[model samples]
Target: MTRESEALSLRVRRVLHAPRAVVFRALIDPDELARWWGPEGFTIPGVERDLRPGGSFRITMRPPDGEAFHLVGEYRLVEPPERLSYTFRWEEPDPEDRETVVDLALRDLPGVGCELHLEQGSFATPSRLALHEEGWSQSLDKLDRLLTAEGRA
Candidate 1:
């Protein structure tokens, strides 16, 4: 199914076969994150998340290229089982490498499904936005598979 949300930002829509609360918890819980946080080939080494406004997150990962990268961000908004917004950046101290805002929202559907819609905005340039869009799409595809498996077991 197509998940569409137009809100002046980059968007991604995925229909998950789980309740909104369950899916939202996976987004907020660090333990659940390590299971499926990145793309198919990446692995998370550390995950620290505080799921409230003014709270932050730190995650470290190793790519297939054997290089380690870190994502550190602060939660800007949190509306439980509904919406989450945050500021994202690479772990580097350099200001030029920091990314913009990422917003994740969950909408409960009529039946036993939930639609996850993500918005990534405030990119420094078009090239950066494009790369983020592709990367997030791939990551969410992995997340879809992961959540589906989790729901089964």
Candidate 2:
């Protein structure tokens, strides 16, 4: 089997309604991330970020039905308004699941807009990959709304 088929990765790009710095903070800062860090209808009751290489973060994502889930990761590389890369893994992981890398690149497009490129994973199953894609998409949507409301658009 091809390498991709063996361990697939998901990639997506989106333009946000904010400047690069704003978008960058939304991804790194605990409060900013809590504002727009999960799927629709999800709330974050707990968030911690150490914000440096080798530093770790943990976020509690509580869904509408309660039973919060935790997302934990460590910073691999962090560059303001430019690039950030980290290792991501759910707190309660699947038996076959492995830690995955998430790389984000932000490009400042003039007129107070930024482009975000997100690449994540090498999942053992398609369902796992799909789950992340859907979650990330929704989170990005919220981020866009948050930034727009901040008048940064």
Candidate 3:
């Protein structure tokens, strides 16, 4: 994993041992997304998605020891096996929370697999940026494990 952070934005890069198409599918497919979409110990109880530009998605996330919460977003761009972008906002946001844009770019690695570049921006504060950084790091770790376990890695 490689991470780059600015005061109000973040970038994370990970090399996945799975093909680009598979990783791209995992991002937009509700079933596959629910299986590995959150930080460690977090589970997804519900996922509703339209999977197209201008469409929307709502994901219910259950923490290890708290009430479930939701994250809602609208798709901005969705190009299969290559790129995706969306607007992300918490349904019930913290005072510091603000809607942000998340962009994902997937590059094929030939014989190896694929590289995923994730960028999210314009946080209200550095603390908010830090929080998202941790969440995304753990979530990507979980995704890697999922793909490996399924023998796609």
lDDT of each: 0.77, 0.90, 0.93
Model 3 misplaced regions, further than 4 Å:
1-6
Please list the residue runs of candidate 2 whose C-alpha ends up more than 4 Å from where it truly belongs after superposition.
5-7
Error of 1 at 18 (Å): 1.3
Error of 2 at 105 (Å): 0.5
Give the per-residue lDDT of model 3 (tens digit) for 1-153. Answer: 223335578889999989999999999999999999988999999999998999999999999999999999999999998999999999999999989999999999988789999999878889999899999999899898899889896
Give per-residue lDDT, candidate 2, residue 80.
90
lDDT of 1: 0.77
Q: Indicate the residue-level lDDT of 38 in model 2.
A: 88
With candidate 2 superimposed using the best TM-score fit, by how many Å does residue 149's alpha carbon deviate from the native?
1.6
Q: Which residue pairs clash within candidate 1? A: none
lDDT of 2 by residue, 18-135 (tens): 8899889888888888889889999999899898999999999999897988889999999997999999998999886778989999998898599999988888788889889999
Ordered from best to worst lDDT, the candidate numbers read 3, 2, 1
> TM-score per candidate, in order?
0.84, 0.93, 0.95
TM-score of 2: 0.93
